[model samples]
Target: MPKTAIVPPGTGKPLAPYVPGILADGILYVSGTLPLDAEAQVVHHGDAAAQTRHVLETIKGVVETAGGTLDDITFNHIFLKDWADYAAINGVYAEYFPGEKPARYCIQCGLVKPEALVEIASVAHLGTATGA
Candidate 1:
């Protein structure tokens, strides 16, 4: 049950002092992810849908690197700068997770980046089925 830190390609320099994701005890804990591009520049400023998509894509990359998939995601904690963008965010979210949706809690809160409309943190279990 050794712990491992993951920093996806093009993650660039982290805005804050935190690992992008950690694998420990058969679970992957993805830190709060933003819509930063390969160079770490925030993308899709002011657009919740696009930002959400980018966040999920980053998460997908991390999960795959850990030998898991979107289906392995069991929970997600979403933070939004505005609640008005809820519907738009959900629209993109459904496309990424069309299966038995992961347990999630989304709240309207101030994000680290002003232009960012959304940020998300997720947890995925990497059991024997998924080859931990």
Candidate 2:
């Protein structure tokens, strides 16, 4: 299978030397996404719910660009700056993956950006495009 870098539009420039997402075979691997806006600036500040939503949305965009929706996500790795915000993050998470949610692991970790309370990475199965 061909390996393709999947970088969706409107994501702005990356802070690190890495692609936003990559597609290999039928799998899509999205890089750890922070709560950055289109200009790559930290958003939502200390609001964990909003920040979590932003991070998930960023991952969603990359997954869709690779020809799959959020339903195709098989697993996700979430990092939170504070364990106290766990409930707030889960509240927003429920809004996205309501039923039969994907496998996920959440842990508290120090994010690269101080204002970023959440970061997420995902694996999705996009299968073959209409005509690969």
Candidate 3:
């Protein structure tokens, strides 16, 4: 059966769709995490690098909550509003993944919300262990 896990402190409002993480068939699918702060407000405005860092950190949190680590990531989908910021984004991304980066596809899209330049979604292999 598919299992869904919601990150703590649910906002009690439907701001964004989908739970933070879902596990099925040994794969954990993490939802796209933006650079939003604790208040759900966008952080690191106007700075692509900082925004990247913020979002990555958030991704790490979700991964851990799902009982996995960044190293377990097998694939990633990156969305960027401006392709020119790829270099800057990569520079910050390297710090998180370090070695053996996951396969990724980056696409330019019109973000649902403004002020967000990048969005990242990941799929991870949580191994055979149950309840990571």
- List all candidate RMSDs to the true structure: 1.9, 1.7, 2.1
Per-residue alpha-carbon lDDT of model 2 for 30-92, expressed as tens digits?
999999977788999889999999888888889888888899999999999999999999999
Q: Report lDDT (CA) for all predictions.
A: 0.87, 0.88, 0.80
Q: Which stretches of candidate 2 lie over 4 Å from their true place?
A: 130-132
Clashes of each: 0, 0, 0
TM-score, per-candidate, Cα-based: 0.93, 0.94, 0.89
Cα lDDT of candidate 2 equals 0.88
Model 2 steric clash total: 0
Which ten contiguous residues of candidate 3 have the minimum total lDDT? 6-15
Model 1 alpha-carbon drift over 4 Å, by segment: 128-132
Candidate 3 per-residue C-alpha lDDT over 18-132 given as tens digits, one digit per residue, 9 for 90 to 100 = 7767777778887887777766777888898999998887777767776788999999999998988899999999999899999999999977668998989999898763444
Please name the candidate that would achieve the greatest lDDT relative to the true structure: 2
Best by TM-score: 2
**Where does candidate 3 stray beyond 4 Å?**
8-14
Flag clash pairs in model 1: none
lDDT of predicted model 1: 0.87
Give a tens-digit lDDT track for model 1, residues 1-132: 678886666566788889888888779999999998767788998788999999999999888877889999999999999989999999999999998999999999988878889999999998743332
